[model samples]
Target: MSGAMRMLAGLYRPVESQTPYGGRSVTFEAMGSAWLACGARRRSERGEGDEHHAVETMSAETRDDPRLETGRVLRFGGADWGIVTVRPLRPGRVGLELERRR
Candidate 1:
């Protein structure tokens, strides 16, 4: 972690559980928190006609953590961001692609 990576983002992993009526439910469990160096947020609009949606994409870098993977959720900046992609930038450095729909 570097001085620039000042934001603390909480990592969450998805957990699948069974319901009382033989149904399945997916929930997120807190894994831990990590220091993230977040980049600028990019916004895009989609859809046609009277309906349109905005999708926000952001990139973040953090130390290598085996628990982090695709589909995990990151809680930061008073919002929950979905982990779109994860890649290794270099030794001990992991890059994450995060997305949030608004």
Candidate 2:
């Protein structure tokens, strides 16, 4: 599913993951090129706790995705972002509401 979808997708960007390697160590792995939305959190409507901080909702494909999880850290566009919520959008796709982690 991803192979065909990736080939057909026009916009692609980079996603980096930090995984715990041996309980006491961490390793950063680069998963090249993903289809995602990266931008400022919408101001039209927001829930409690969202208004105070600058955040963004990043949506990406879920199929074969191992980089997104609760408490997981990701680097996009040279900044660190923490995974706040990973929501399944539809077949072969998912949406990640990320909070900027400084």
Candidate 3:
């Protein structure tokens, strides 16, 4: 598999966890571009709490599809971080599928 695919595939592995709400599937996406690293957390239906992570939406010309972009801001930690194009691959699978310019 390609480097990008390998990174995503590794992250897609099923993980077991328990939250205050209840037990739910662990779904998350992470990507690194240059010196930036961003990620997003999917909400678990089993839990009533709001998802802590947030994402954005974007459209691509080469790829005619919509995707969710996850990101956040942190001043204390370091530079501002942001997510750019996140899309669902299937029912319970999602990840980044864009090329970042250097």
Query: Which candidate has the top score in TM-score?
Result: 1
The CA lDDT at 11 in model 2 is 20
lDDT at position 11, candidate 1: 92
Better of 1 and 3 by lDDT: 1
Estimated TM-score per prediction? 0.81, 0.45, 0.22
Worst 10 residues of 2 by lDDT: 4-13
lDDT string, candidate 1, 5-100, tens digits: 358989999899999999999998999998889888899998799999999999889999998899999999899999999999999999999999
Candidate 3 accuracy as TM-score: 0.22
lDDT of 1: 0.90
Global Cα RMSD, each model: 2.9, 8.7, 13.0
Q: Which 10 successive residues of model 3 have the least lDDT summed?
A: 4-13
Model 2 spans > 4 angstroms off? 1-33, 42-64
Better of 1 and 2 by lDDT: 1
Over the stretch 2-102, how does candidate 2's per-residue lDDT look in tens digits?
33222112222334454566344345444444455543444233447745544455444444365556666566556566667777877766766666522
Candidate ordering by TM-score (highest first): 1, 2, 3
List ranges where model 3 is wrong by over 4 Å.
Answer: 1-5, 8-69, 72-82, 98-101
